[model samples]
Target: MRKVILSGMLCCALTATFTIDAVAANSALVSPDRRISVALFIDAHDQAQYQISHDRQPVLLASGLGLALSDRQFLNNIRSIKPSDITEINEHYQLYSGKQSQVDYSANQQQFVLTNDKMQQLEITFRVSNDGVAFRYRALEDKRIDKQSPKPVSVVEEYTRFNLPQQSRAWLQPIAEAQTGWEHTNPSYEEHYQMDIPVDQPSTSPAGWVFPALFKIGNKTDNTWMAITEAGVTANDHASRLQARSPKGEYAIGLPMAAEVFTGKALLSHDTLPLQTPWRVIAIGSLATIADSTLGTDLAEPSAMDTRFIKPGIASWSWGLLKDDATVYSVQQQFIDHAADMHWQYTLIDADWDQKIGDDKLKQLVDYAAGKNVGIWVWYNSSGAWNTTKYSPKSRLLTAETRQQEFAKLHNLGVKGVKIDFFAGDGQSMMAYYHDILNDAAKYELLVNFHGTTLPRGLSRTYPNLLSAEAVKGFEMITFFQEAADKEASHSAMLPFTRNLFDPMDFTPTTFNDIPNIKRKTTNAFELALPILFVSGIQHIVETPAGMKTVPTFVKSVMQQLPTHWDESRFIAGYPSKLAVFARRAGDTWFVAGINGEAEAKTITLDLSFLQTMGGNIEMIVSDGERGFQTHKVVLSAKTEIKLQGNDGFIIRITPKS
Candidate 1:
């Protein structure tokens, strides 16, 4: 049996509070007495310390039994404690190598320092505010540690293999193999992995696992962690999960929220926290829809927080993969046609647009697109030579002064936005360059879409016109490559909990047809649902006019009707690897999307209780059928029960009926 413990003060404070039953094991009550009885669970062993406190009040609860990794001296001291010395349960939480570590603590340290004899030592300072805490981790090379280093630090590549249960193999087969490694080299060593999880049981909530890995800073190695917080489906509830990936060296002091949420993963590090480093926070609300209504206004831009550079608008190349002049003209025409048909507010032209942007051919295309009630956007390669080849000196707009002058010229030509690309990732000098681009772009009133860059850091709040950025592996690669698809679905599911926590992502959506050679299991309906599922401010429904014609009428209708903004949002249900459901409200209409990562049929139902108070019938548009990719042909009035197929999903648009 799971043990529940309440401190004396907490019990006293909650004497006559309203009693709310645990609807499920994870559910808890926020009592009027200012006490919250969260269903806490932790797996640990030996001398490790785990405690939960509310508003500074300590609560000693039962912790899980497991081995603890700490300083060698500390472990040696605690080894003598018998199993009886610690509370033990019949069923102990098992610890798996590479699985997430369990550690939770709260501190009020003004400055934190981290170092290992083998690596560099860094320092960090924290500032607490009403909203939350803010801090930076910095990396410095220790001459002593550097001299003793074993090898010049390089990334290690690992491939994961898992034998799935026969029932779960169908969806698991595609992505059974993945290559993992860290891509960013910064304040610390970071690693990336691709893996899949299978869900085959029925329960109110699904079992979850935390994944751990080792990161080497100088000569010292620290462990990083990520967890699939929730999985599986439950009746009348949506599925969802939360995941965080950060350096293990700062796990104890770095990750506090990982413990606040009942389910999630963490990396444990015994060393001190690093100083002056910029960490990335991404929180996506839905798997298919990237926009989070609560993100920009309430979270991203808090008045008291430090301001970072911001860029706005969607990337043109994401919507139209134009490699040359002709493709650019063709895509410009398509954008014009689609913009008018879909009431799209802005269109972006990606890189290489200026190769022949000054010629009569290009000018005609721009004029034609503008005439069709569409705005044109051009792309530029940051710091690349723009005056050579098809993009001649005549079309070149170099230097800050020239850039501003050209912005005026483009504005005269009715250009609406600009997609900047090919930013070389170097040191702080490059960082300063990126910031300058954003500042200059703002001067010209040109919305920006940053490609091949760092993650967003709440710049959108300062510049509401800034739309989205592409830091994550997005849908464009799906057009020609199958290499990333297996992890794509799972990665999409993970974003809501990790990457999206920071700001909006420009993960261009709704590519209905697979490009020439790529392997694809997704259908037109699935494509249409992405705009409603992914939390992106500016959405891209990329398809050739001919390809668009081939899409099913219902799918096209749904894509045309999808909205980019929402009034409210909720995570109905899901785990990071199995399934995820998100419901968003845009005025009277509520749009909900359910995406599955596992193989096999699953049932999902949305609670209509929120709608009951409205006291009216609701119109529903649901897509689910024998073919997971096929659109649901029938339009029905609300009844509640809905079924979803494995590796498939549905989009529902509900409006209150008079």
Candidate 2:
């Protein structure tokens, strides 16, 4: 506990968390093209604050900027300010699998040097790309400190906040990790989304919302969307999310808390000082613009693994909504046989693979899968590496020495990857564990999928072998609630702009078996389009051999060719949270998918003027005749239109016609 110094009525939110008297000065760093800008300055009370505006409208409100430390350092105080230094950056890189294989971007940067009363220094740097703005703080160690100064460690709290315009709203869900081990996990992360919620009284939850929190910064007509989240999260620090300051307060950056899991006594991190926090990213513009933004991967640290080992493709996964028959050896071979016949790249052998009907049976399945020309992946309880807790079996991976041994054993067994599950928090230890596992997986050239863990912050870029993350309300939830299907269409529409914008999603698309009692949310035709709609490097489809037997052969034929990643991505037309249309290209062929969220029919148009500009007379593979997977060839034109019934989807393929 500490003293609370009384200051004048504090401006709400980041208006002025830290107070000291001073003359106000403001400066902005603009995008090279002058379209996006981030302004920075100190308030009358020397509290550092910043705001972002795109195309001349405020996207982020005036918010406080600083960190509170148990060490009592006032890191955001501005003793004196130097005009910001401006710099220009232009670069390009290749993604093993993404909306696009290559990305070209340029941005402008503005940096300021700030020092507190004690002469402790900190730097606030902002990068304003045409697509978004990201800011990070660097604590500069002062050499003038006494030799006896204790090594500065840990972040007690964060003052960084996003005060959205009152008219603006957010699409959010509570974190599942916070409720994982609790007595009642009612508000688990697996719950449905609360859409288009106003900022003033954001949500009913006391725990706040999760990352990639999508916010619409203006009225319906203004249509400016922005997501407030973090990126480049390293082992040195834990990841963070927005929490309402008061139950009715605006959102502020804070660590995840589950009471028992993250006791108030536990701070955000213990990394040494002179540290740089992960970037707080704001991807601006429309849902499509959010989907097209490169800031997420751009802000992430680059890959540390050989690109050769990173093979991202559609895998057949067990232990999800459907695949349960494979509990024993004989039945497991059928999945391998089907995977080979379908030409799918990988088959995941989920949990319980280590018991008596286990490794021996697993080896048989592994060898059988290999001959069938398919690779195998397995799931493990990451915590069990240390002790038996939660899903941790005695065979779990806990220590580095053990991780090495496990990876080696799996590697020799011909396992292509591992899905480490049940990471219930995002504290420093949890964050470090993620990093350590990524490094170890890299050594064995094993790709990874993180389940029951914090959202991926472009870790796939930093460690290319780390594939998809199942942190979203994916297809698995369909097995849990009847309402799951009711929410699917809008949820699918919202995901591209929200969750999938920054990280690849493992929605486990393409399921055909009807639920026992609940009405299926979408059509097999709509389901046919998911491989194109939801973007993930490893697009795991939840189809078991038994389930696929009942699916239409034509639909299965198209499902066989869903591209896991694209060479390019573009946002087409549609309203937010209602309807969405997306276009992606893998190479010479292009895939366009649309989802209709209404209870009645809706129509949307496609303008192929871009294709015409590239001078191509193409073949059109249309799926709009009351059948989603019905494929037909037609001469492509600059304009085409179609009508979709409520809760339905459609897809079209454009390939050049010689």
Report the number of the highest-lDDT candidate: 2
TM-score of 1: 0.57
Among all windows of 10 consecutive residues in model 2, the one with the lowest summed lDDT is 1-10
Error of 1 at 75 (Å): 22
Q: Candidate 1 lDDT, tens digit per residue, 1-658?
A: 2222222112111122122233111222122223323222111222212222223222212221111122112211222211101111121111110001111112122333333233334333332221122233333345555445523221111011111112221111110001111221111111123333222211111111121111111111211112111111111111111112112211221111112110121212212221123321111112222222222222222222122322222222334443355445665666667666655655666555555345455567567766765556666655342112232222233456777777677666656666665433322334444455556666656666665444444445434444566655676656545765555566565555444433456667666555656666654445555666676666665665566666566666655556546556666666555666677776677766767666566776556445555533343344445222453432332445567555566776666675
Q: In model 1, how large is the Cα lDDT of residue 568?
A: 61
Give per-residue lDDT, candidate 2, residue 94: 69
Q: Please count the clashing residue pairs in each candidate, in the order shown.
A: 47, 9
Model 1 ranges with Cα > 4 A deviation: 1-326, 359-367, 383-399, 613-639, 656-658
lDDT of 1: 0.39
Q: Rate the local accuracy (lDDT) of all candidates.
A: 0.39, 0.70
